[model samples]
Target: MRRVRQLAERTPADRERYVDLLRAVAITAVVLGHWTVAVVGYDAAGRPTGRSALPDLPWAYPLTWVAQVMPVFFVVGGFANAASLAARRARGGDAADWLLDRSARLVRPTTVLVLVLAAGALVARLAGVDPSTTRTVVWFATVPLWFLAAYLLVVPLTPLTYALHRRYGLAVPVVMAALVGLGDLARSTDHAGLALGNYLFGWLAVHQLGYVWYDARRKVGARFPPARGVGWTLLLGGLTVLVLLTTVGPYPVSMLNVPGEPLDNAAPPSLALLVLTITQLGLIMVLREPAERWLRRPGPWQAVIAVNAVVLTVFLWHLSAAILLVGGLDAVGLLPTPPVGSPAWLAWRVPWLLMLAVVLAALVAIFGPVEARAGRHRLPVKDAAPDGADRPSDARHQRHPLRAGLAVAGFVAVGAALVMNAVTPREAAEPLGLPVPALLAYLAGAGVLRVLRERPDTRGPTPPASPR
Candidate 1:
């Protein structure tokens, strides 16, 4: 444990850019994937079917390779957890408080969003909309809520997870691999006794790998690249696993595809996912320097950073915007039913998707300010130390990365599990719950806001020197 602590402290602060860029890329992929899958359909009663029309697009399956970016989100999340924990520990703060503070920051905004959406759904139903259409809108609107639950489950378990990472080191991967293999075997034989553990054990395993990478970066610094030979080997290994699982393995390649079985890789995720994470991590490591360089550019990087700040808002509202656009357009008699799988039908969808983006942008423009206002109270202002004094003993300064990580894991695990059990029993306890991703997005948005608030603007005009 002492050795691990020392290693975690060695890396400088600027080494985190790669992970941030990776996060930006991952969120973008998710948005695009959702857009591609958006299609307008209706039942015989003239009500919207709330399903995608482009189900047969040749590019849909292959999109999974790039669009299934959730693993990368977890990896970056682990990195942020490590950094925050280490910062807090150095300031002499209690690990529990650090975790609690972060948890509140994540959960508060999400609760606001979910409650708002839920209320809207209820009102819509009372307006006499078809039951199926109302249900579809509500379900799609709540998709982003699953992240919140999943993340809350993981947040509280951070301490235990960090301890496991320290004690087991690379053995963490081995254990996760075993869980995946065992889960797969059980799933194959129609026994899902251990299936409930996949979200925690399986995906958490990948998050733990992010911890390993975080520790590794601290030891070697950002500029140090992995040997070319080793990098290619890991890359090839990840791709090989992905190919086998998608093509030959019982699982389908389309990460979005819903299987009939109780255990769906698209939902809670499976071991094959860790392979994808490993591959992504290796690829990031190989291009770390270049990626960092690219991200340093103000024009593009600023946009990336801006989007990162509002990623949660985007994820939670994108589907709602799409649904609204489709329903609104259909009411105006601008769209008519077309044969499925036809080029003409798909062409018609392009305009609606664009309109959806506009609606989403409008929502962001309006609600973004509201969310920011709410976020201000939820996130501790970085510049505002306790009593405005630079107390080293303050919680912000004394947080340890390992402890913070553990606290986060613990909070998320307990909170999400409880929420899932209460709301959606079948999907809640499993990976399909909305709590995890919502929690992550909430945390990330809060973290970014805190960092931005705390960080001094080095590029701005120089202030007059204070008299001594």
Candidate 2:
């Protein structure tokens, strides 16, 4: 707590408080949204069955548009990654160095959770738990990795994408969004599943928009970052497009994946999702100044810093915490089995949220240091030699471009594998009973990235000279 407060106090006045605030809010909403929408019950055979209540609750569809904050995350990511890359590049850093620094924070928290999950799966299966039950529970627990996977894939490509943004300016996003639309069009035809490319294209487009945001801030005054009324335009325009697409087109209105739904707006990220994201980004931009002002208060700012300090850990472990709470409660008959959307079920949401929060809090306390270490890794050096200590030269620090490419390929494989496994779980057990191939991919890819971290100083990131 003291360290959190001290770190908050040291926050630069020029910092973009709104960015961190948005990130904190977005992830929190996702955790809460997941807890609220899931409806779990037991079948006639006494196996626990879990399903999303989205398709059943028609009124809940619109709520997803608001609740699905993945768009916001990508945008913020664009904003941050752009800043980080520029800073590193100015220091003569290469893509590999930038990727190493960015991904190191992700590595620690992710590894701890993945190992624990693999062990948990092994234990469950060895205890004679039904294969389906163990699979469902473990699958749900690791579902949070999807965001990490996607974000990891994007982080390494910032050099390439940001360059595209610089050369083509706004044309980049226009083309990217167009590709998403084409993918969606192809998805609607006999080749219903042909839009796989949009998964990368759609997210990269949203992320590119973040670069647009950052660039906008750089040109205009950061104090009033977004152009006036841009938010209004996006909100109205995106809302209209979303309505038209869902009603007149093949895309479903719900932003979340619905069980048994033929076409989800968010599965591969359709054109409609990009439109909705414009609305979200506009809303975020419009509120930037006000949010920044609110964040200036020490009380509020400290809370934001504290959350950001361990945000990755909180996000990665949230589902596992919920899974533990739900499964444990169910095993003891403490978990209620009310029909989803019933009055009783609605009433139970408060307690369910409270319990999930409690368990997640415990998880964060235990594993959050892994994430906290990442932030401190970027802090300026407090101690140095009298004559100013030297560090690795730019050339030595830069991984050979080809080697960097291979490293990136590894991370991309991890991310793509995660999305595949999460959407389509494998029923078979592994050598140690690790059920998901994505988990193995994630661990293996991370290992490759780490070994490639062969920088002169392997503690991780090179500390910024000014702590900027």
Overall lDDT per candidate, in order of appearance: 0.59, 0.75
Give per-residue CA lDDT, model 1, range 270-376, as digits (tens).
76676777777667667776777776665555555456556667766777787677778788987555666677766766775677789999977765654444333
In angstroms, how far off is 298's CA in candidate 1?
1.4
Clashes of each: 59, 0
Estimate the lDDT of model 1. 0.59
Span of 10 residues, lowest total lDDT, candidate 2? 381-390
lDDT value for model 2: 0.75
RMSD of each: 9.7, 4.4
**Residue 85: error of model 1 in Å?**
1.3
TM-score of 1: 0.76
Cα error, candidate 2, residue 95 (Å): 1.4
Candidate 2 lDDT, tens digit per residue, 20-79? 788899999988898898897887877566678887898888888899899999998897
